[model samples]
Target: MINNSSHVNWRPTADIQSLRQRAVIIANIRQFFALRNVLEVETPCLSNATVSDLHMRAFCTQFNDPMSPQQKTLYLQTSPEYAMKRLLCAGSGAIYQIAKAFRNEEAGKYHNPEFTMLEWYRPDFDHVQLMNELDELVQQIVGCEPSNRMTYQQSFKEHLSLDPLSASLEELQKRGCALGYEHICRDEQDKDTILQLLFSHEIEPNIAKQRPCFIYDFPASQAALARINLQDQRVAERFELYYKGIELANGFHELANVSEQRQRFDADNAQRRAFDLPPVVTDEFFLAALESGLPNCAGVAVGIDRLIMLALNKTKIAQVIAFNYQNA
Candidate 1:
């Protein structure tokens, strides 16, 4: 005897209207890219490796093979970045993908274990150019006002009155403490980590409230897959778009040097060790693609659900998606 009544609350989180609006927006996005000749593409949802970023967690599952006497663990891709870049190395011209990505993270109004991502790459385009195109796309879909561009240094200076580029570790920590964050964890006291904490807590809420904006040229330490600026080695050619102080996208001038990428991956593993987190293995296939000459390109990943949320004036991501994590 089992009970299967109304206790489950089995219904979609989003309404029918939202689903229709989402479809229209997605169609518009495809048309926007199609006009620019950017081909839509797809990649595997599972991967042999995972993100090395110290802040993110990846979900994993075991795969057993009948033809072989071994079981291999597969990670749900946190982003389709590495695989997409492999396609770029294979000379798949300008490409875009609306993908489902996964990350084991704290559930919140803005976060889910599984979410939709709109990612793309453009050859011969720098981060600046990508920002321009992204701004156009956002305006086209969400009808936001034209976005403005600001450098990361300018943002920190305007908001905190501190120079993030040359700020010492002690200075950053001191600022964090002054901002009432005295009990931060020991493992998270690194320069970039502290900077991110300050940015998210103090700065993000105040940026681009009236219109969208792009903040570019991030600290070299926080580059991730972005290439470092040649003229100013202290910063990397990375940018993020924000609307009403909410982050909408992140872009980077793709790092093409194999040796430098390997070094960055090792550095990430070292940081993971410092934080007592399991070190993630580097994706050799991605590195091999880089070695075989990835074309010079700029790339970005956007949150489609978030975009839908903004478009519908919905506060929670669940209001824009068919099923949220809990409901699903």
Candidate 2:
């Protein structure tokens, strides 16, 4: 951590020109939402509840009040999904937010421990329709080619000649090991995780490096908050948009069933227990909002730093942001 005692230069990671360019792109993004009449809103960045998704982790902090006897623990939100959904339940029409989000144990060329997130929810829109909107956003901002859609299963087969949906654990492991991942494969036992590893390592990098690609219909188990497809229960209505090997956005055809949502959260905790990872408390307030009935909607969270990186042709996420996590 760069603190008072640390001998580090106190300067912006991005140059003056990059900061100005970033400002312009963000201005245009706000205009894009304004033209579409999407209501811009803000939500509390710190909350009592954190995401229970198996792969997500929130930064924990303490809120100490001088008058209170206890210090309450609060979590830095990983995304604005829960709070935004509550707004939707409260009848906030189509909404959007450009906010700061934090995630633990994330820092690299493409990610930072803290980053900017542009999230939006569109009532009455399904994942497909949202993809169209997202494509327009990327094209207008980043000038990428028209996007393409490939299902989760099709992407695997097209790239590696493997069927991710039906492949058994042993089969998947064999394929992964064949791709020179035997060392990493030995420690991983989860099938969904293995598929993801293979995809990120081998498949994603080789996709259209310049154009946007949308891959949807992920395995049901991989669905964090997406609704299962009626046509094919084997997959969920989740979609991800990628450009130049970097995932730009993750969108879901929202799931509104309170009971099913609870079940999924429970399953995630159970898996955490099995993996020796600490379980997290589900957000009951969000559950109550779900019970109150969330209108049909499609929502997506976009990595604003990544989009800026693409627009400016910068290689590292640190090149576009004012301060990387290290400096912050």
Candidate 3:
């Protein structure tokens, strides 16, 4: 992790010309929202609750009072999701936030410990509408061509020739072994993990290297906070946008069912216990808002750093940032 005391010579992540070009993209994005009537909003950086996704780890900190030696637990929010949803419940119409978010132990060509996120929510819009908006926005910003939509199942079939949701553990293991995958975890791995392995190893790399692709309709177990399709209960209304093999954004058909949300949170906490990670407190305020009803909406979180990297044609995520991990 980068700190403020480093003496190493470091350079900005992107070249000045490229960075300036990306600034235009940022401006275009804001203008797109402004024209759509989506209110640009801001929320707290510190929150008492963290995301309940088992794979998402929050950075926890302690606050001590000068008068006493007691410390209070606080966490750097991974995203502005929960707070934004609460505002939606309070009748805050379509909203968007371009903010900096922090995550521990993530530093790579596509990831950073501290990075910018462009998150937005659309009230009364479902996953399909959200996908259209994403495509239009990307095209407007980068002058990229229109994007194509494919379900997760379709992507798997097109690349791996396997039906991810129906594939058995033995079948997955056989495919992995054929591909020379080591440390087979078929017995412990779920459908999502199995599909993810194949997707990363064989499928994703070959997709629209220069164009944007929208992959949607994930399996129910992998939905995270999204709602499952009532018509096809096996799949959830979730989508992820990929460009040049880099994930740019993730979106979901918002799940406002408080009971189901609670169930998912409990399951995540249980997994955290199994993994020996500290338990995260549930956000009762967010739950109250959920209970009050969240509009049938779709929301997305986009990685600003990766967007800049792609726009600048930079090879590393560190190039866009002022300081990198080794320098900081």
The prediction achieving the highest TM-score against the true structure is 1
The TM-score measured for candidate 3 stands at 0.93
Estimate candidate 2's alpha-carbon lDDT, on a 0 to 1 scale.
0.93
Candidate 3's C-alpha lDDT?
Answer: 0.85
State the lDDT of candidate 3 residue by residue for 109-220, as single tens digits.
7788788899999988998899999888777665677887789899989988999888887788878777877475445456566667888879889886768999999989
Worst 10 residues of 2 by lDDT: 1-10
Q: What TM-score do all the candidates reach, one by one?
A: 0.97, 0.96, 0.93
**How much lDDT does each candidate structure score?**
0.92, 0.93, 0.85
Q: Candidate 1: TM-score?
A: 0.97
- The C-alpha stretches of model 1 lying farther than 4 A from their native spots are 185-188
User: After superposition, which runs of candidate 2 have C-alpha atoms over 4 Å from their true positions?
Assistant: 1-7, 66-68
Model 1 RMSD in angstroms:
1.3
* Full candidate order by lDDT, most accurate first: 2, 1, 3
| lDDT (tens digit, per residue) of candidate 2 on 150-238 | 99999999998999889999998898888899987766788988899988998889876768999999999888999999999999999
